[model samples]
Target chain A: MVTGPRTLAQVSEGDLLAEIFPYFAAHDGLLIGPGDDAAVIATGGSVVATTDAMVRGRDWVDEWSTAADVATKAFTQNVADVAAMGAVPTSLLVTLVADPQTPVQWAVDFACTLGRLAQESSVAVAGGDLSSAPTGTLMVSVTALGDLGGRRPVLRSGAAPGDTVAVCGTLGRSAAGLALLQQDLGALAEVDGLRAECVAHHLRPVAPVEAGPAAAGAGATSMLDLSDGLLRDGDRIARASGVRIALDSELLRPDTDVLAQVVGGAEALECVLAGGEEHSLLATFAGALPDGWRPLGRVEVGEGVTLDGSPQAPRGWDHFAG
Target chain B: MVTGPRTLAQVSEGDLLAEIFPYFAAHDGLLIGPGDDAAVIATGGSVVATTDAMVRGRDWVDEWSTAADVATKAFTQNVADVAAMGAVPTSLLVTLVADPQTPVQWAVDFACTLGRLAQESSVAVAGGDLSSAPTGTLMVSVTALGDLGGRRPVLRSGAAPGDTVAVCGTLGRSAAGLALLQQDLGALAEVDGLRAECVAHHLRPVAPVEAGPAAAGAGATSMLDLSDGLLRDGDRIARASGVRIALDSELLRPDTDVLAQVVGGAEALECVLAGGEEHSLLATFAGALPDGWRPLGRVEVGEGVTLDGSPQAPRGWDHFAG
Candidate 1:
C-alpha cells in the first residue's frame, strides 16, 4: 500500500524524493547509479535509451495533475519506450527547471515521486539537474536507460508478413480522462473505481513491464509502444518492417464496452485505433502465439496499415502537424 | 567561427534545440541517447553521472553573456562537477525550455555553439528534450556521463596529513572576469592581455580535462575541481578527508601581476583563495611530489583550511545560503 501524507498534494517533490529513495538500496552492479552527485549504471553489454520532455502548460497541471502524478506519468512513459524495444528499464536521468516562485519543497516532493516510481520499476533516477527558469513553466526531461539482457533487441524494423500482431495494456483511458477533465465532467466522481481509473490512467500509466521480456523470450521480431496511437505507431512498425498491417474490428470489441456510451461506437473504435499515449506494448510475433496472446491483427504483404483489409479512416496525433 | 542567421534576442528555445542537435553524429556505443524519441549510452565497466540545471535570467543573459558564452559556461560548469572525482566526461544530455516569443534562431545558434564545444571536448550531446516556456526565460539542464576507465576513482576523500597539494590550470581569471563584468570596468579593456582574460574567463571556462586521468595515474590520494573557490573547496576536501590544509601565499605571488591593477595584491590573493567556478583541478598526492607539480599548499594533521598556517577566512558559494 502507498503510505505517507493523506494526499500527495500536501507533500513537496523534493521531500518525496528524499523519502522514498533511501528505501531502495543500491546494487553492486550500480557502480555509479543513483544518490550522491550522480548515478552510474553498468553498460558493458548493451544499453538502449531514449529521452522525452514535458512542460508545465503543455504537459500537465497543478489543478488537475499533482506533482506526484506528473512524476509517475513521466517515469512510466519513459519506461514504455524502453519496454517497446524488448529491454528491461535500468535507469532514468531527469532534468528539471523551476521558476523563482516555485516552492523548493514541491520540487523535492516531485523528485521523491519520481524516485518511488523508478524504484518500483527497478530503474534508478541516477542523476539530474535543477535550476530556476525565467518563466512559470516547469520543464522536465527524462532519459530512460535499458539493458538488452543478452538478447537481441527487437527493433521497429523486423516484422515479417504473416506474423501475428498483438498488444498488451489498456488503451484510450488517458484520452477519455483528458476529455472528461476538459469537459469538467464530475458526474463520474461518485464511482471510486471509475474515478480512480480515469485519474490513475492519466496520472500514472502502468506500462506492460513484463510483456517486453516475455515477448523477447517468445521470439518477437519487432515491437513498439502505442504512444502516438495504435494506428499511427502500427504504421511506423509497418513502414520500418516493410509489411502491411490489417486489423480485425471483432477483436477490438472489448474496448467498446467502456467507451461506447461516452463517445459512440464509431468514435470509440477510432480512439482505440488512433488515440495516442496509451503506452501499450504493440509487437509482431513470428511464430506460434503464446498461451495468453489475444490477437487483434496480422501482418500482410502490402506496405501500409488497414482496418479489416481496408484503408483506416482516422489519422494519428502529430505534435508538429496542425 | 560561429555562424548563424538569428540574434540571441530573436529566437525561441524549442526551435533552437531542434535545429542545433542535427549536427551531432551518434556512435554505436550510444544505442539510444539523443534522438528517435529517446536516447541510450553504453556502460562499459561502470558509469559516473550528474545533472545540473541553469535558467536564463536566473543564471545569465544575452544582455551580458553571449549565447556561446552561456553555452560554454553551462558545459564547463557541469563537466567540472564530474571531473571533480577524476572522471572523464564521455557524453552529455541537455534539455531546454524557451518561450515562443523568444528568437528561434538565437536558440539554434546557441545549440550550434554548444555542439561545437561538445565536439571540441570530444564529448557529444547524446540526447535531450525541447519544450516551450513562458516569456523571458531560458532553462537548460545538462546530465553529464563519464567513464572511469577502470581506474580507482579518486574521490573527495582519502587525503592524508602528509599529502602534497597541487593545482592544474590557471586560477583567479574567472573571478577577475566576473569582477570586470559586475563593475562594467572598461579600464581593463585598455590592458590587452587583461581584457582577453576578462572575456575568455567569463565567457568560456577552460576545465582541466586531462588532469583527472593524470592525477589518477600519478597515485593521487584525493582530488576535486576548483569550482567553489580554492579556499572553500579545500575546506570540503579537508572535511571529507578529516585533515587540515595550509596554503602558501608565496606560491601565488605570480598571479599578482594580473590582478595588481583591478584588485590589490591582497584582494587578488583573496579571489584566488576564495573565488569560485574556475574549473581548475585541485588534487592531493601522497609521498614525494610528481615532476611538473605546481605546489600550492600542503595537507596537514588537523581540520579546516589555513592560509599561511592560520585558519583561512570562510569564503565559498553555497546554493542555499545567501
Candidate 2:
C-alpha cells in the first residue's frame, strides 16, 4: 500500500521481486525462472553468449530517456550481439544496480517494458540480480544467450576477397536522434514527422534481430552488428578477416537521404558513416543477398576499411578515447 | 609502451582491448572469445544462467579491497549461483563500467586476476563489454553459464518433511572477517593465523562449488547458496518449500568455534546465525550425507525457520532496507 513517489529504500527486496516477477511471462525454453538461485534454459549443442552494460550519464541522460527507453536500448544491444553471430536469442539475464533512493517506478517501468519486449522477441526472462549502488548512480547490465540451431556461427573472420558486404535495417538514426536531443530540437517532433521518428529512434533504437540468421542461411561468410558505427564495426571485420571493406557511397545514399530529412545532408551522411548504437546487421555473403538486405560494399585483398577507394580513418564512439 | 599511473582516458579502446586480451587463455568450450559481437560456447542439453553485479562504495570500499579482490568476489558470487542449481560452471561474460579517469592498472589487474581465476575454476572467458561511467562510479557485472550435465536441477522448493539439512562449507567466516575489518583489526593478521584467514575470507570468500553437483548426486532434495546469511536464506527455503527448517545450535558449534578464534565466542555465534556473503552450499537431503557435508538440522511440518525449538527472526542484509 506504499505510494507517493516511493523509493526503493522503503520496500523489501522480496516485495519488489514479487511485484516485478509477474511482468515476465513463462517461456518453454526456460526450465526454471526467477525465485531460484539460478535459471535453467533448454539449449542447443552450442550457445551464443554476450554481455553489455549501460551506465547513467555516460549512456543515457534521465532528461532525455525514460526507464522504458533505457530498458529498450539495453535489450536491443544485447540481442543484436547474439543475432550478429547468426544465433536466435533465447534468453536474457538482467542486473540492475541502482541507488536505494531511486524511485521504485523506474525499476517497475524497466521490468515491465523489458518483459514485454522479451515476449515480442520470443526470448525468455531468466534469473537476475538486484544490488544497491552509491548515491545518484543507476546502471543496467544484460547478458543475452542464444541458440545456434545447428548452423556454423557467422564469424567476423570468415569473409573472403569476393564476399559481398551488405547491411539490413536503418543506420545513423540513433546518432541523429542523439544530436537532436543534444540541441534541444526535440520540439521539432511536434511538427515534423521525420524528426519525430529520428527522436524516437534515438530514444529506443530497434534492430532487425531476425535478419542475422537469414543472412547466415543465405550463405553469409562473416557478420556482426553495427554497434559502434559502420566504419568501426566494418573495420573490425576487415581486421579479423585480414581484408579490406570497400564501401560505395552510392549504395549508402538511401540511408543518408532518410537521415538528411531530420539532420542536415552533410551531417546525415557523416552520421551514416560514423554514428554508433544503430544495432543494424552488417554481413558479408558469398552468394546472393537475402531478402530485405541492401548492398553496401565489397571485400577486397587489403587491410582496414576504404570508402570509394580511399582509406577511411577508424572514427567512432570509443568510451575511453580522448 | 605506456607507464606510470595512466588513466583509461589516455588509451584507445582498441589498444586497451589488445592489452587486456592476452590475459585470458583459450578453453575447449569457447568456440569464440572476445573480439566478436558474441562468443559461442559448447553446451549440454541445458544451460544454467545467472547474473550478479557489484558497485564500488556499496559492495566494497577501495580501502579494504583492490581490483583483483573485487574481481575474485564478483566471479565467486556468480559461479556460486550456478553451482547452487546443481550445474558445472562453463563460461562467463563480464562487463566493466567505470569512469574514464579510472586507472589503467586497475582494469589490467582485474582482467588478469579474473583470467587466472577463470582458469583455476575451469570456466572460459567467453566475451565481455567495456563502457565508461559517470565520474566516481565503478561497477562490474558478471553472467555465468553452466552445464547441467544431464542431472535434474535441485530447486529451492523441493525440500520435504524429515529431510536432513546439511552445509558443505565453512560458515560465519566471512561475517567474522567483515567484523574484523570494520574494527580495524586487519593489522592483527600479522600476529594471528585465524585473523588472517578471516580477513582473507571476507575479501574473497570461496564457495564449495563442486559440492553442489555432488550433493545432487547424493540425492539432495533442495539446495541454495548461503549469500544472505543462514537464517534469512533458510527462511527462503522454508517459504518456498512450504516447510519448516529446525536447526540445532549444538550442531552449529563447529562453525561458531572456528569463528570464535577471530571474533569472540558470543559474536561468532551471532555471526554464524546472521552473517552474509558466506557463499557456502546449504542443502536438504532425503538420504545419507556426502563426505564433505556436515549435518545441521532437519525439515519439519511447518513454515519458516527455528533455532533450538524457538522461532528465529529473519535478520540479514536486504540491500534496500533502511
Candidate 3:
C-alpha cells in the first residue's frame, strides 16, 4: 500500500521499497545512503567481508522460523563465514526481500534481531536494502565485514605433507539433533543428554572464533570451518593441498560419547565421520598442536584420501543426488 | 561426489581450512591477520560498501542462469549498489552454497565471472567461500567496497520545496522488458526497437557511472537512482523532504518512447511512472537544471503527490500489495 493514507490495493513493488528506506536514515555509518540503487559504508583498510542468504523453504521453516529467527540466522551464518576465515566481524549489511502484506513489524523484528546479534557478536548493523517479492517466501541476504587487524589471511590452500590435522570445538551434534528432530524420536530421548545435545546442535551454533587466531599464531598450515560433513570437507583440503589425507576413525570414537547410546559405536563413528554443520575449526599444523587442538589426522604427499592409511569410499550429502 | 580419492574425506573442514591460509601471503594494507575469529581491514580513511544476493528462482533462472550469469549478476548488482551511492567500486567478497554435485567448472565459471565483472567495474574479487548444500540451488552473495574520495554523499533526505527533480540515464526500459519477458510475448521482434530495449534492459544494465559524480559536483541536495518507478520514487523525496511532489508527466514522455509501441501511451506512462531497475540517477536541485538533466517535477511544501499541479493517485509498485 502507498504510504500517508494512500491505501491503494494493488501497488507496485517499487513503491513499497521506496517507502521502506527512510526508516534507516538515522544510521551513522551509512556514509553514502539508501533508496538509491545501493548503500555504502566507510571502511578503514582491508575490510573483512562475507555474505549469506537464506531462502524461506530451503533454509528455515515458515512455521517455526520467526522473523527474528530468520534475521538472526542470516546474520550468524554470514558472521560464521568471516569467523571461519579467522576474521573479526565488525559490521553487518542485510538485504531483505519479502512478499507484499508481510507485516511491517516482521521487517522491523528482523532488523532488530540482526541488530541484537550484531551487537552480541561485536559487530554493528551497517546498512541494507529492502525489496518486495511476489511470492510467499522471504529471502534475506546478509553481508558481514571483519577487521583483520593486520594479519595474514587464513585461506584454504596451504596444507602440506607432514602437517598434522587438528580441530577445536564440538562436531556432528547438529546432524544427530536434526535426525532426531526429523524422525520425531521422542521415545529415544534418553541417550546421554541427546535431546539437549540435539537442540544445542540445531538451534544456535557458536563458531570457534578464538580457535582461528590460536591456530594462526601457532603456525597453522591451513584451515577452514566444517559446514559440510567431515568426510567431504576433508576432501576439499586434500584436493586443494594436492596431497593424500588420512584419518584414524579410532580417534573420533572418544568424541562420540553423546551419540553412543542412540546409534551405537558404528553410527556414532559415522556421525563424527560424515555429519556436518559442526562449525568447528579444522587446521593443519606444521609443528606442535596448539593448546586446545586435538590431532586427528595427517597430510601426506600423494593423492586421494585414506582411512587408517587405506583408501576409503566417499559418503555424504549431494544436492543433485537422485 | 566427495572428492580426493577417499582418505582425505575424513580430515574435517576445519583442519582443511586451517591448512589454506599461507596462500594469502600477499597484500600491503593488511592490518589484522586472519585466525582471530574474524578478519579486519584497516581502511586508512575511506571505505565504501554494498551487498547483493541471488536466490535461485527469484532472481534468475537455474537452467538459463549459467554460473557465469549467476556470478555476474551477484557482482554487478552489488557494484551497481555502491556506484549508485556515488562511490567507486573497489573490492568484493563472495559466499556461495550449493549441492556438492555442482560441477567444479560451475564454481570456476562463477569465480571467473565475478572477477571479470569486478574488473569491468574497476573492483577486485578479494575473497570468497564455497560450501555444500543438500538441495541444489545456487545462492550467491556478494559484498562490495568502494572509495568515496572526499565528496559528501548525495542522500535521499535533503530535497527541499522548489527543488527541481530530474533524472540522468534511461528509464522505463527495464520494467517494460520485464513485462514482455514475463508474458513470454515474442512481440519484441514485431515492435520496432522493442527487442533491443528488452534485451538492453534485461541482460546488462548499465548504471550511470559518470552521472553520480556529476550530481555530486553539481551540488545535488537530495539524490537517488530511479531503481523503482518515478512517480513512486518521487513520493519518497516528497515524504523525506516533507513536501508535495508534482510531476509534469509530459516531461517524462521522452524516456518512455521505447515502450510506446508495445504498451501504448497510457500503459507506457504507467511503466515509466512505476517501473524499477532503471538505475538512473534522480536528484532534487534548488536551481537551474544541468545540460542533460531533464526536468520532470518539483517539490512543494504541501501534502501528497500531484501530476502537473493537480492531485494524482499513486499507482506505483508495492511489495506487499496483492
TM-score, cand. 3 vs. native:
0.77
Across residues A131-233, which tens digit of lDDT does each residue of candidate 2 receive? 9988999999999999989999999999999889999998898899889988999877778888888888888988999998878788899999998999999
Interface root-mean-square deviation, candidate 1: 5.1
Go through the candidates in order and give each one's DockQ: 0.39, 0.87, 0.31
**Residue A49 lDDT in model 3?**
69
Candidate 1 clash total? 40
What is each predicted model's overall lDDT from 0 to 1? 0.71, 0.91, 0.65
- Superior candidate under TM-score, 1 versus 2: 2
Best by TM-score: 2
TM-score of chain B of 1: 0.90
lDDT, model 2, position B115: 93
DockQ winner, 1 or 2: 2
lDDT of 3 at A295: 81
Judged by DockQ cut-offs, is candidate 3 incorrect, acceptable, medium or high?
acceptable
lDDT accuracy of residue B226 in candidate 3:
66
Q: Label model 1 with its docking quality class.
A: acceptable
| lDDT by residue (tens digit), candidate 1, A1-322 | 8454333233444444555456444654566544333455776555666667777876787788777877877887888888877788887877766654555555657777887777776676666655445536577777777777877777788899889998887767766666667777634645756645755676667788778877887998888888778888888788788898888888777775676655567777777888777888888888876555578789999877898878774367653221
| Ranking according to lDDT, highest score first | 2, 1, 3
Model 3 agreement with the true structure over A1-322: per-residue lDDT tens digits: 4554332124444554445444333444445454444555555456776665676665666554677767755665676667666666666777776655566667666766767666665665666765545446466777777655555667666889999988887767767766666676633555547666664555556676767766776778777777667777777677777987788766666677767665566777777777766677787889999887788888998866687888766556433233
B126: Cα error in model 1, Å: 2.8
Clashing pairs in 2: none
